[model samples]
Target: MANPAVMVLGATGRIGRLLQLCPPQGLHLRLQARRAQAGNSTGDWHIFDPRAEPAALARAAEGAAVLLCLAGPVPGRGGADADMADHVRLGEAAVRAGASAGARVLLASSAAVYGARGGLLAEDAALRPASAYGAAKAQMEARAAALGAELGVPVCSLRIGNIAGLDAALGGWRPGFTLDRFAGGRTPRRSYIGARTLAEVLAALLAAPVLPPVLNLAQPGAVEMGALLQAAGRPFAVRAAPAAAIPEVALDAARLQALLPAPLAAADPVQMAAEWALLEPEMAER
Candidate 1:
């Protein structure tokens, strides 16, 4: 088959959702839309919520060769405070669905899976998950890895970073994601990756020849806050905050590089900020 069929669980996310709508050359797409998103009549919308639409998902996975697990809470509406059953449910659902269809599962793990502290995390660094969210992801990874080992099925869990691009509260970051905030002149540093780059990474993960259930999927750069303001045609004192000092961690993406020719890994925050400032002219408005 020229295009490998893939089911995306979180097809409404910044990355997975975009791929379902505009799939690459080798992917024939199927998306898992939740109950509320049933009205989303875009793309090849499949009414499948990993948490509830298992039957629809099973059908969608039929004959598909890859499963991209990307669904998660958007902050508040999360799992029960007692257990991360929600995360476990999705992981289990995807594994079952993929095993039935003879497909590989690509799980969307997170950089947060590391912890809320600062450190340069390698692919195999010891996990020190801080938040309930991080702990849940750790549990999810265990499930994915076990499935991959026992079933001889490949599973890739990517620890993603601050996904940039639209949908982010900060839009049109032509001044850059952090820079746009600093344009107001005095903002904290942030980590970011272009949405397209993130989408590309997800696409590559499902197709990678070898599946590593745990991998870092972030651009290699620290988003400097001051640099961001400069790009917005505004000058502000910038500071490099310790990434590990923040909850949203920074990542080393050499692992992402070996996966595909997705060279956008170089779109570091510094480069992005500099390029933006160079390309766009400042308004004289004070």
Candidate 2:
């Protein structure tokens, strides 16, 4: 049998670049970038502008078995309202293109859709998004699901958790990003997945014969912010602070684990931090 043809939108984003780095075997990749770049020489490249040229999106999705919509407005580049609107628009376009091509659509969604909800949030949790970004994701998922049903195409929304990359996690902080704290003076717990693990899970999902309507893509266990910071060689400051009612955002990824071929081990924050420490210098030079 010929390798399955996979069309990937948002091929220049962080998740898209990771997919490029370790592409799945036995699959033909078709990558779509918003603008043409001179140096990229991998896969079938298409200059797709979902908003400006919907026809281009349909053309790129032709004869594909799976369409992964990883497209979204770059974070922190635009106002929250504008970005959210763009996400909804892009999602609608992606669903239309994939449905027209008779392909299963995978929407890369976010756990933020649950918003300020504490404990193990399952796929069926009510979406009460606390922020604009979270609300946007919720809207995207809803639109995709409705479009897929209307067009008779299978759609899966992967509600991904924190993609704690080497630098992003170890650097302690970044502009426009904040860590959550619980009311009891403890660091808020969050479900997190390493970048490599995230890529692997995505590959597995692409290959699965059956997919759930929604799945939480997170590691088995939650990580404490204090533990993670300490593991990254940073001081844990909120240890003695007064506790607030901040919600601990932990996802229950049991459904995802059941679909994978092998069982997933719980993530080790300290080990992950150590690995990132070693690779930080190397990543900086590139």
Candidate 3:
């Protein structure tokens, strides 16, 4: 018997880089990107754009048991109609390719879908997106789920929280960075997951027998921005929070917790910082 083959779309991005740095064992990984890069490893590499070459996805997913779609617009990408449509088409392609086999599709979604709604959000919480990016992701989840059901393909949308080194507060830090302090003198708090932990979670999901249509991906607890900065020994200034500042955006992981084999311990800022430190050398080279 062979290990499950997993096709990773958007293999040149942040999470992809993290996975490449510390990939899971016992899985045959096939990495796909929009084009060939100058310095990426040459193993199991496929070059094609899912947006322009949507039809090619069927061929790319052949014999793969999992199609992980990490290819989506970033914050500055505008998340236009065309950009959001790319996810739907990619999901369609995944379903089309997996129709014959018992393959499953995992679409990368974001907590942005929760928008301005503060507090611990659940999978069933009503979406109230405030930014264009959030709106686009919310739309993607709906369209992908609907299409997956219609085509009899098992689809799961991972509503991921802030990744350790990929978030604005920590990763985007610079000298004289400013943070918003709310009325109670508390800095913003958000659910965060370590990059290595994220990889483990994904690998676990791939090996699971059943999956929910929608699942929130994050460590057990939320961390304060101040604590994270202190953990990293980064300096920043504090400013009064604006009216639009959201104090917290946490995801309730009860449903997700029930699915995992062991408990995912609550997020620790020091631990998250340490995990990100392991990938800093590679990040600097990029």
Candidate 4:
């Protein structure tokens, strides 16, 4: 039997770059991007703009066992309509392509779909998006699920939580950017997963024969902003916001944990921060 071919859209973003750096073994990766760059064309890369070339996108997904839709507009970068439209189109395209090829579609949805709701958020929680970005993701998830059911394609929406990256918990902190406190000067708690752990989970999901329709991807425990900042050895000041004003999403990842072979350890925010600090200088030199 041949290795399964996997297609990854938006193969140049932050998570995409991490996937490239630490690629999963035993799979043929077809990384797709909107445009070709100088150094990003080594592997099986296909440049197909979903906006311009719908056929090209389908072609890229053909003969693949899994189609991972990671392409979407960044929050705060464009108008709400434009951002929403971008993801809507991408989700539609992915469903059409995956249905045609009989490939399992995995859409990377955001935990922001739950809005500012505190407490344990399950996969079945009501979606009440606070921001435009959250609204767009909720719509995207709906569209993908509807299309998958209509077209008889296996589709899974992963509601991912805060991902700790190199610059996230370990880098230099700015006033408002790094420290976000809720009302009464309390640090908001949020579920987080390390970048490497996220990649590994994604790879495992790709290999699974059966998948749940929706699952929350997060670590076991939650982390606070103050703890993260202190772990990074950065001094920061917090501005108090209204109670429950700051969106703090904590996910219950029991479903995902059961799927994995071993226990998915909770991400230690401070440890991840320290590790990133150690790796920052080395990464910069490369």
Model 3 alpha-carbon drift over 4 Å, by segment: 77-85, 100-102
lDDT of 4 by residue, 136-250 (tens): 8888888888989999998888899877653343343565564566766667677888767777888898888889999999889888867777776677776666554664668
State which candidate, 1 or 2, has the greater TM-score.
2
Tens digits of per-residue lDDT, candidate 2, 1-286, equal 8899888988877778777766887788899898877556756889868778988888888899999988886446455545567778888888898878988989888888998887689999999887777888899999888988898888898898876663234444653444555566566677887766777888899988779889999888888766777777665344333343344788998999999999777977876576455544544432
TM-score order of candidates, top first: 3, 4, 2, 1
- Residue 175 alpha-carbon offset, candidate 3, angstroms: 1.4
Give the per-residue lDDT digits (tens) of candidate 3, residues 255-281. 888999898999999999998888778
Tens digit of lDDT per residue, candidate 1, span 137-194? Answer: 9888988788767777777787877654332322343332332222334354445665
What TM-score goes with each of the models?
A: 0.76, 0.87, 0.94, 0.90
Q: Sort by lDDT, best first: what order?
A: 3, 4, 2, 1
Q: lDDT per prediction?
A: 0.65, 0.77, 0.83, 0.79
Model 2 misplacement above 4 A = 79-81, 166-184, 234-245, 274-286
Task: Mark the regions of model 1 whose C-alpha exceeds 4 Å error after superposition.
Answer: 20-22, 36-39, 77-84, 166-191, 229-248, 270-286
Deviation (Å) of 58 in candidate 2: 1.4
Per-model C-alpha RMSD? 6.5, 3.2, 2.0, 2.6
lDDT for predicted candidate 3 compared with the true structure:
0.83
Q: What is the lDDT, from 0 to 100, of the residue 254 in candidate 1?
A: 75
